[model samples]
Target: MTLLAESPVAVGPPAAPPADRMTRRHKLILTLLLGTQFMLTVDFSILNVALPALGADLGFAKENLQWVATAFALPAAGFTLLFGRFGDLLGRRRLFLTGMTLLAAASLLGGLAQSQEVIIAARVLQGLATAMATPAALSLLTTSFPEGPLRSRALGLNGALLSGGFTAGALFGGVLTDVLTWRWAFLLNLPIALLVLVLAPAVIRESRTPDKVRLDVPGAVTVTAGLLALTYGFTAAGTYGWGDPSALVPLLASAVLLTAFYLIERRAAAPLAPVRILNRPSVKWGNLGGFLAFGMETAVIFMMTLYLQDVLHYSALATGLAFAVPGVAAVVAGLGASRIIGRFGSQATLVGGLVVQAAANVGLLFLGTDRHWFIVVLAVLGIGFYGNVTAIVGFNVTATSGLPDEEQGLATGLTTLTQQIGFTLGIPLLSSIVAAGAAGYGSTTAPALALLGGIRLGVAVDIAVTVLGLVLIAVFLRRAARKNAV
Candidate 1:
């Protein structure tokens, strides 16, 4: 039964009343959960523009600053799924609040951090907090909202948040950094978290599974370690050289451990991997394309902000203004996506977005400027202005509805993990690629132009690869259509 079905079943032993009817109180709870998610996402995206300012305050070098971002991503990536499954087994509400506490503390510490190590450490703590809180937040939302129009409406708003955050982050980061201080970026969470924390217990109901399930500690550890090691490997490769033993060693171990994890999941009861989802070509291809798109998107904003501030010499606010296209585009896309999907089918929409994005990338390539200023390149950059998130968000809501309610916890967890891991790993990889290429240019115009050139090519490659992924979508969707016709 969808969470939105408004028939009153008696309230159960676990918590939260059975939904037979709607109440204003119920909507209030949903709002609190959504607020939690928005805060986490905003915190996640806000730091991109603020990174340069952060380095100035903390004295971290250009090369090492990736760690600041990596610190949050690595642990968050590692822990999300593992903790998510735990929430499935244990209790979502308990994990949710616990994570909130830890995340809040880390944010406080991060705001006060004086050195690179301290900031990095705080970031990892922040990651851990989000790791616990994020899945719980999703599971709560999915469980609370009754399926159908209400759920769809709620999910659409949530989808807006996934990209809406970028706009808020860019604008807010520049504002906070310019006026108050870069540390305020981290500190800003305090009030928002404080607001939600106060409201959660009162508004949100407690929830847990009725039956007992064994916790998969071994599976969780190995997978978490594997992801952490892999991320560490990719991140260190940029600095210590790709061939460095320190970098290569952990990555190899990550591979072995993950392989073992798959084997374990195959046999284990209540498997952590959820084998059925892995078998779908739609899910697999979607995840691959999503990763590439996310990585490229991060690079778009991260390096662009650098090009704007460090190279082009734009202020934080101007830099934020420069990105108005993506934020606005994303919001429009989110609102209209259902109708678009209805008209075109998922496959067509996916292809359309990629084609548009590819054009944006190519435009950026040809529109290069000798100066760092973004004014000239804004129109060009608009070409690569597409994302898989809106499509995927809808897919998730629809597909997972067919799934049993108990399974939705990890369903939400898995999608979140794919995007986070992609962002965590993609940023360093793309940035490093651009940096390496820039080094080859060796002249003033050559270096800046090289950076733009590399990104342009990166977007071109994204376009090609995305269109190729679209091929899979076309094949699969047609096959589905034929089967449905039969």
Candidate 2:
């Protein structure tokens, strides 16, 4: 993909603007694009606090309940690459508007769903909408802003909105579930989606790649099939234990499919992901960091929600309110990210953020059944969230820093793809660890202690994974920096 300033893609390239300074119109455009991103992210976690309520009301079995989250995440993670390239082939403005309309419709369907199958289908539709909108919206932002301070600031704010949306969704989901009905959680998206739909045509301009690129159908099929199989295997492992054929067969198939995907992409006429871009260290390591940043934070939210409601017996509203502090902190960190990156550099910001997150995970080890203990938990989570904000902003900037303008959609697609995959995989993997540990208590430990032990184990897994991410960033990113310097 090549994006030329003088590219033939646009019927009329947007009027040339001052290269460095942002205009009021630019700010409005950013707001509208970010709003769409926020909605997409919100749906990812909106169901977290509502899970229990939703399960009980819908008559979902305990093992089948996680599917509610997975159903949305799977399509979003698996199909984003195809949709991202689609946005470049088709008009981005058209795709963005269509996605919003579908998202609103899905939310309505979810609210009105009578059977579990209907609700799960609605969630899948929502995921498809997200897959379509996010890349288009992000590509629009990168093209609208030049690749400098203006772009860096925009990415930082976008990261902030993304994190804020997830945190806020947890709170809002709880409030709606407690005050009205769990169905309200889905219904709430209607107004926001409708509003974005109404205003989007005026604010967002259309953009696409001028040179026609054929879709890599074989590559797309293999990668999507691979991710689905992989995600399902992990989820099945959580439900049926690692020894079951239910888990092993899918895991093996995923391995074969993903291998085929790589081989196919290597030779495809128009690769779903270009080989050279995937080989860039900055792109590779930056996305790894991003995966950790998104994955662990989501796991934290899921675990905390379960801990507060299942063990501490907090109401949905209370659980949501508890997460507000950390959520606010995440926004602040996002807002300040450009300055932080300017002072410390993207590498430093990312590594430091991961370290802080690791420390916060350690702090979670002290959580007890007492509601008063949440004060400390929320405080520590705020600090961790701040780190997450910095890492998210820094990783995004680094990942796309050297890519050509034509590949902006691909870069952004890779970025969001890693995040969606993280959310899809993290919950089940971490939840399984907690469940396995909890089940092992076997009447030896007190039931309360056993549950707390499981929760602590979950926190420990988060810490270990985060530390591993920090190590990878330190080693790989530093090596890339040295290579570039030389």
Candidate 3:
């Protein structure tokens, strides 16, 4: 049977749930799910601000400090698809609870670690926990709420809190490190995880694919290895330059492994990612839109970070404070995104959001060394954050709307993978552009000017990429509409 055979159409707010059914119980379930999501996202960036303190306390070599973050990110990105499929085969609630348990243990271990190896090991466990939990939690959320304003609202809150968590991590990491210790950053997860463990079984329902399907081990292995290689390659490129063998070798390996995965999926009796699902116009275009939206937004944030610290010379605290504006904007956008999608439909919201984001990048082209320009920078970032959040919600709605409950895990997995890959690759790609732009200016150019030139170049590229994505999404969605009509 074709699992995702429905004609791909633009998703609008579907029929609303009965007023009585939309009760406090539903709200509690949403809070639990969103809280889980928030904790995972917070772990991604919480260590960044604490890196210095962590490295000093652990006696980490300067060159090896990146590993702390990389350890968590690599497994989180690489194993997500596999674990997502597992959630379908096993039970989502079971996997989710297990992941939460592991996360709590890992956090405790990391907080109490005395050596570098132990801390890195703990981070790896945490990464594994994230990989297992994310898609499971997401699939649960999507399945729990019926397709309509309810799901849109849940997704909007999900996107908003995801952004908020990253921002909060950075903000709180610094404060926690200064006031108490870096260990508290990891220890914080313990309580959150414990709370989820206590309440989840009571609120979240268990779900899995009803059909008994055999696992596609080859497909799983190849795709997991491929993603790992791909993520590691980009990360290495960010640190060691694109030309370095450390980046080149893995990039090449990733290409080969991913190709093998495609071939395996075509032949596998029960493919991890079904070909029919992937071939759907909504799934294909929606994911591409998500990839572009997330990649460019992350690239912009990295560039802005450099601009704030290197050219504008803001202290770390000052820079974090400045970004709080965008964080708040994301929350506001999240609050309103469902209403907008309900009114405009997902297609219009997605396209409009991308356009607004692109326009905001254009505004950043004017950012310069003058201190007064910081205001413009903040304003545009706030606008961009709002657009990004809205687009993210639209992406989630569009990509997963037509799929059956049995396939929700795979659908959520693909959406989650796009996000992780976008975050993994965005910085390196734009950093390369920035570096090339600066290098073209030669040695005699003022250091700050060269960096500024590079930042502008990166922003321009962000604008171009967003525009291209908008065009592609519009064209494909239009084509899908015509095909459905015929």
Ranking by TM-score: 2, 3, 1
Candidates sorted by lDDT, best first: 2, 3, 1
Regions of candidate 1 where Cα sits further than 4 Å from its true position = 1-26, 285-293, 342-351, 370-389, 398-401, 404-407, 442-446
Writing each residue's lDDT as its tens digit, candidate 3 over 1-486 gives 112222111112342544424556668878998999988987877776677679999999865777787888789888888887777777788889999999999999999999999999999999999988887787777766676777788889998887667666666676677778999889999989999999999887677666677778998899999989987887777567788899899999999999999998888877777776788788888988888877888678768767876788765566656767777988998899988988988877888888888888898998878888889988998899899888888888888787675555556668888876676567667876787677668899998899899899989988998899889998999899799999
For lDDT, the strongest prediction is 2
The predicted structure with the larger TM-score, 2 or 3, is 2
- How much lDDT does each candidate structure score? 0.66, 0.82, 0.80
**lDDT tens digits by residue: candidate 2, 1-486:** 121222324322464654767778788888888988887887888888988899999899977988898898778877777777677777888888888899999999999999999999999999999888887787777777767788899999988888888888898898888898989888988998888888888877667776776777898899989988888887787777777899899999999999999899878767887666778788888888888888888788888888888878888899999889878998899989999888998878878888887887788888888888777778887998998888899888988887665555557667877767876788877887787777678888877667778889988988998898889878988898799999
lDDT against true structure, model 3:
0.80
lDDT of 3 at 210: 64
lDDT of the structure predicted as candidate 2: 0.82
Tens digits of per-residue lDDT for model 1, 1-486: 111111222111233444545467657866777778777777776777788889987788888877887888888888877777666556777788888888789899999998888898899998888888887777677666665545555555565566566556776788887788888888888888888778777766666655666667778888999999988887787677567897889889999999988888878776666666655444555455455455555556666776677656679877877777666666676677656656665455555655565456554555445564365556644445434445444544444444444445545556567666766776666665566556556676555566666565555555565567656755775686587679
- Measured against the true structure, the TM-scores of the candidates, in listed sequence, are 0.87, 0.94, 0.89
Which wins on lDDT, candidate 1 or candidate 3? 3
Which residue pairs show backbone clashes in model 2? 2-406, 3-406
